[model samples]
Each structure stands twice: as C-alpha cells, then as structure tokens.
Target: MGGNKVAIVTGGARGIGRGCALALAEKGLDIAIVDMLEPEMARTVGEITALGRVARWYVADVADHARAAVVVGQVAADFGRIDVLVNNAGRGNPKGILEITEEEFDRTIAVNLKSCFNFIQPVVPVMRAGGGGRIVSMSSLNAHSGGVTSAVSKFSYAAAKAGIIGLTRALAKELGPEIAINCVCPGVIETELGNSLTKARGPELMKGIALGRLGTPRDVAGLVAFLATVEPNFITGQDFIIDGFQWVV
Candidate 1:
C-alpha cells in the first residue's frame, strides 16, 4: 500500500469539509471524500481532480460504525495508503434540553462525537500500517464557550464537540509515536449550514471578534492543512481555536 499521500475527509461535500479537502489536495494529497450529499460530493471530486490529484467520493453516513469500517477498507484498497483523516462531519442541534427527545440527543452524540470513534478505530490500524499519519478532527468553539444565546447549536452540539476534544487527547496517547492526532475549534464560520446564524448575528458577532469579521471555511481549512502537512510534527492532542479571538463567546 504505497503511493502519494492520501486523506479522507468526512462531510467533504460542501462547506468546511470541502475547503479542507481542496486544501489538502493542493498540498499534493489524493482525496477521498465521505459524505451523503451526492451532487455536492461530485462537484468537490471534480474540483479536486482539476487540481491534478486523485479524488473519489464515498456515500455513507459518518455516524454508521459498520459503514465507516467498510468505507475505510475501500479507501485503503483504492488509494493504497492513508496519510490523513479529517473528521469534519457534524450537524447542529438547535433544541434545548427541555425540548429535545432522547433519540435526538443520542443521534447528535452519534453523529458529532461517536462518529469520530467509528472512523478512527478503523483508520488507525491502516495509518499505523502505512508507517504513520496525522488526524485532525473538527470540533467547535462551542465546546469551550457552551455557545451564545442566539447560537444555532446548543447543549447537545456542544457536548458532542467537547467529547471530540477528550477523544483527541486520549487517542493522542493511545496512538502516539505511530500517529499524531489533534482537533480544531472554530468560532462562527460563514458556511451554508451556518449562514442563518451569520446573517442574523454577523454585525453583532464581528464587534466581539478581534478580527472584526466572521470566519470562512478556508479560515478553518488552513489550520487543518497545516496540521495535516506539517513535517516532523511535534504537536498532538491540542485543540487549536481558529475563532479570531471572539471574546463574547
């Protein structure tokens, strides 16, 4: 299993995942996109291909454990090696504790938190077999701030993102020397999923941010690409906050 570097980016159909995938491809890594959005995924694959890199899309839910294993196997078989795994697939939960159902809470955890475990377990072995690799998971500033009052993601989403931090720390120890793992916590980023919140709070939110503006998918993608491609990496288990210093949240 040997070729150019390869990366698997979950939720790579659009938004932040798309940015990460394109950034990695620009860094000369083949991209394997995992997402449920067919048209968007196809568009992203074409974009990566246009960058002169191999690009493939896998249709699967990130929260499915068995499916994650299957997809990882297929990626290894198709790409011949796994160099990076970006766990970026997640959904926001706007419901409060009082209104959310038990199933809804569980699904939020499964999709946002447990899904990391599902992919990491299978990808870790493949990465180890490939000699060594890097893992950058997408957490959120909500993990630290508990989100603002007008935020679209609330308690359940924050909890899941926080779990990603814990998982990154623990796995850094468990998979160390063979694999380097880290997570990133981005503040209010302007993406399709996040536009509603941004449109409503853009001006108000910018006032609190040191940068005096909201963030973009490329803003987060740059950090992820750095963590993935940084040579002789000495960093792991750390959560890099790319929030432009938003003091309000």
Candidate 2:
C-alpha cells in the first residue's frame, strides 16, 4: 500500500463524484476513480491528469463486495498506496417503500449502504499498513426527515441513507486513533440527480434553503475533499450536513 496522499473516489465518473475527485486532485493527491461508466470515468481522469496528478480508473459496481475487493487490490497495486477513500457511489431512488419492489430495495441498499462496507473492509488493512487514512461517505439530508423536502424518496431511500449514518458512527469508533472516517449529508444538490428530482418536484424545493439556493456537487465535494485531504481533523463518526439548514435533527 502507498502512503497518506493518495485517494480513491468511487462514482468518480460524473457529478459530485467527479467534483470530489477533481478537488482532491487539485489539493495535490494522486487519485484512483472507481466507477461503472468508462466514458465519464475517462473524462474525470483526463481532468486529473491535466492538473498534473496521477489518475487511474476502474470500471466496477461497488455494490458487489467481490468486485470491490478486486478493484481495491488493483488500486493498491496501481497507486502503490491508498490514503483516502471517498464513498461517493450511490443510486438516487425516488421510489417509496410501497412503490419499490423487494429487488429494488435490496439493490438500493447494496449500492447506497453496503457498498461502503464492501470497500471499507478491504481498504482498512491497506491504510493501516500505510500508517493511517481518512474516509468520507456520502449521505443525504433526506435521511433525516424522510425526504419531505423533495418527496422523491419515501422509505427505501430514507432507510438506506439512515443506514449510512449508522454505519459511519459504528465504524468511527472501531477505526479511530488511526484512521478518520465521516459522512456528509447534503440537501438538494445541483447535480443530475437533483435536477431529475427537481423535474418531479419542481423548483419549490428551494423554498427554505438557508443558503438561498440548492447545494452543488462541488459544494459537497469541497467538504469531502477537506475531510480526506486535511489531516489532524480529530473528527470521526460525525455527520456533516451540507444542506442550508433545512433541518437540524
């Protein structure tokens, strides 16, 4: 494994993932992107290279633990180390529990929640060997209030996001004193996912955004990059909300 300065960002092909990868690259870290889309992944990699940072891409569905393991190993081999892991790969599920089927729920949980563990497990040893590391996973404000702001996700999505918070808290204690891990819950981000939800919910979702507008991928990405790149944060198991004071629970 490599030393603290390399990063692996999942779902780095587009949107928030891309933004996170770029920001971290700009922060002077070599990046490895794990994503399913080759074209988009290439775009992000190209941007990283232009910024003079080493970039690698792996086309893998992180929801599959087996695939994630193999990919993580490849990343370790390619980068010669692993420092930060940004779990930015997730699916936007707008289906209510009643509207979603069993398969959909299982898949959503795997993609949004379980995938974090899938990579977290294998990457832990790599980071430990390199001394220590930082990890940041993506959550959502919807997890706090059942997505009432958008009404796009009712049960399944909310449950998965809530699960992310639980997972982050539990893991933080176990991995502490060496590795730092945290979660980010952003509200109504201005990304493809947000735009689609906006199409269904209209622009009214901006009603009470404390910042006077929806959050951007870059907005959330900045927070993720900070947690991953900035050291001695002395922070873990915390949920950092990027939403403009939508809810405080």
Candidate 3:
C-alpha cells in the first residue's frame, strides 16, 4: 500500500502462492491476490498488511479469462500500475493419462495451463503501457520427468507444467527488453499439499535430492522476488529448477 510497485499473485491464498505474495510484500510491493479461496485469501491479506503492504483479494477462478481479465484490470487501476505478475495458480493432477477421466483432464489443463494465458493476456497490455514488468509462473519437477512413480500424473500434469515453460519462453521473446518472463519447476516443497504428497516417501524423496532435503516455498519465492525487483532484467525465457538437484533437468 505504501510502496509504488504492485504485484498480482494468483492462488495467493496458500501454499507457494502465499509464499510468493508475502515475499513480494517484504520487498515493499503492494499485493493483489487472485484466488478462489476466500478465507485463506483473507489470511494472506492479513500477513501482507502486517508487512506494511497494501493488499486485496479477488475471488475467482484464474482459468476463466473473462473473470480474470476483470480482476487484472481492477488491480491495475487500484494500484495505478502493475509491476509484476506471478502465475502460481495450479492444481496437482494425480491420475495418469489412461486412468484420468476426460473431465478431469480438462479441469487440469484449465487450472494449470490456460489460467496462465488468461491473466497474461490482460496484464501484458498494462505492463507494456507502464514500460516494463516481470512474470514468474510455477511449473513443477513433473515437467521434466513426467513424474516419479505411479502415484503422480505421468501425462496430464507433466504436459501442463511443460506448457508453462514453453509459454514463458515465447512470451519472453515477444515481451523482451521490457517484460521479463520466466517459469520455475519446483520439486517437493514443504507446503501442506506437498507434505501430504510426500508423507509416505519422505526418506525416498530426500535421497533423490542432492541437498538431502526438499525445497521450501520460500526458496521458490525468493527467486520470484528477485525476478520482479531486480534491475536491468537480462534474465528471461528461463525455467529455473528449485529441486535441490533431484530432477536436475
């Protein structure tokens, strides 16, 4: 609120999304949380306010382009400008291709991939008008490996995550010298959902990580904060892997 820079964090209610919002707020940026979880969104807003940043939440599914456009426009107007966009909104698709229903597959693509396109379309115009901006979207280690075992999705999730990387690369080429766009494929973070996924495989997971530990949301958030706030932005079209060298690809 007090700062001039403003950032919009999708899925900013919890998990890595909340981490990214708080990190940006810590760096003195106003926050606009685009998420459907109203209660969690309020909690995240409180944290941002505690850090002395202006914060607001818009309840809507990010995959809906029309609704997403309205919120993005409102944020630009309310903050007077949009400095960064973090497309961290996504859901884990647990079923493999053959096991997943058609509806489930569609939902996964809508939330994990199409949502990026939805918000980016509206925000780009605002960023271009403002002269520059930063975009950091969340992909996953699944993008590289397709997934570890029969537990995680082998096709849908991996495809969606890979799409984010491809989308980021193309956007960087189009928005370069102005807006910097990048994606990160994080592996086994300690968020509630992440912990649940790894509960049975903690020891096995740790063995895969060269650092002997899984990543934290803060680790991923720190990179996003840097991409948004750092100057002379030469870094774009990159897919950063924050998995402690587990799925190094």
Candidate 4:
C-alpha cells in the first residue's frame, strides 16, 4: 500500500503478468519481478524503476521449487519484507484427452498449479513475519466453463485451474488473518498467448463471448490490483471471474 511495501509478481516479464506488475508499481509498491525471460524481465524492471519504485528482477522457471526458494529468499533479503505475492506465471496446453500426452498434462499442472505452491510456500513465512500479506493467483474461466478450443477442450487445463482455486481456499484458511489468498479467473483475454489460441480456434470462439469482444490483460490486472491492495482483509479464499459476462450467457 505504501511506497516502502514490496511485492513480487511471477512471470512479470510480459502479458497479464506485466500488466499486474505495472499496476502495482503505479500504486507505489517496490517490486520484485520473477520470470524466465531475461531481456523482458529487465525491461519490466526498468519500467517499474521509472515509476520511482525500487525494482528487481529474478530469472527462473516458476515450476522449479528449489530455484523459487532461492529467488524468493533473495527478494526477502533485498526488499526487507514481501507484502504481496502474485502468482501469474502459467502455461496452457490445448490438446484433447486422446491427443494430450501424460508429460504434457503433468507440465500444465506443474506450471499452472504447482508453481503457485512454490512461490507461496517461501513467501508465507516472510509475509507472516511482516505481520500480513496478500496473494493473488491467475486462474482461467475455462476452469469453470469448458474450453472452446479443440486443444484444451479435453479438460486438463480446467482441472489444473480448478486445483488453483482449491489451493487458494486451503492456504487462505491455513494463513488466516495473517495472509489473504485469492484467485482471479479470466476469460478470453487478448494477450499474445490469448490471441494465438483464438487464432488457432477461429472466429467462432469470439462470437461465443457475450461481450462480443475478447478481454484484455489490463481488464484482469485491474481486478488483481484491487484485491491485492484494498483491505479490511475480509475477502479471502474467493475466486473472482473476469469473463465479461461470457459465463452468464
């Protein structure tokens, strides 16, 4: 909330993650951006620094628990405390059940679900030590409504995202008033990854959205930033869907 408070956003190099990083930075929180993309990560750091907030970048795969621990520890050492953790790094595999291999399924679960645990586990103690914290995980509308794309329509991605909701609830209970954990499930956002998937699926996918247009990363980021900063600390363990009413229709 203050300029001195520190936040970490995983996969903050680009897309939805980048939007969240910028949103938080604009709010005056120093940021630690973790991503596998070195150049892009550095660019995000530069942007945050230009915002007059301290910014640091850590390059590592979110799925690697050991590396995540080290990176988070380094962040704690650098920032003195971590006030918010946004688990925004994830991968979507759009293959039908018959077409999806076990390895691919595992990778999807690892990135989308396990990575949340990897980042949260280390940061929980840091947050508790700092008195309290906020955690926002990136989820997908496909987790509730089935995916329209032929690739992910099989169910693995949805299942993995659903798992994220479960984890958010369980962790929220475990952390109690000390930390708040929540998930944001976005629908058909027009990020580079989203556009690629939409192109892969064709125009019919766009027509299905009640809004008649795809969502954007900023649309989702706005909600994420709100949940992270606004606090009487009552909202926890909830999953907010930003689908432009697509699910309603």
The candidate that achieves the highest TM-score relative to the unseen native structure: 1
Better of 2 and 4 by lDDT: 4
How many residue pairs clash in each candidate at the backbone level? 0, 3, 2, 3
Model 3 alpha-carbon drift over 4 Å, by segment: 1-3, 148-152, 247-249
User: Could you tell me how far off, in angstroms, the CA of residue 104 lies in candidate 2 after the best superposition?
Assistant: 0.6
lDDT of each residue in 1-249, candidate 4, tens digit only = 122889999999999999999999998889999999999999989988999889999988999999999999999998899999999998778687888899999988988899999999999999988889999999888788767444443488788889999999998889888899999999777877787767775476766777778888889889999999995668999999897777431
For residues 154-208, what per-residue lDDT tens digits would candidate 2 score against the true structure?
A: 6777788899999999999999878999999988777777777766654465666
What is the TM-score (0 to 1) of candidate 2?
A: 0.95
CA RMSD, predictions in order:
0.8, 1.9, 2.0, 2.2
Model 4, runs deviating above 4 Å: 1-3, 148-154, 200-202, 247-249
Once fitted onto the true fold, the runs of candidate 1 whose alpha carbons sit more than 4 angstroms away are none
Ranking by TM-score: 1, 3, 2, 4
The lowest-lDDT stretch of 10 consecutive residues in candidate 2 is 201-210
TM-score of each: 0.98, 0.95, 0.95, 0.94
Candidate 1 lDDT at 45 equals 100
In model 1, the worst 10-residue window by lDDT is 145-154
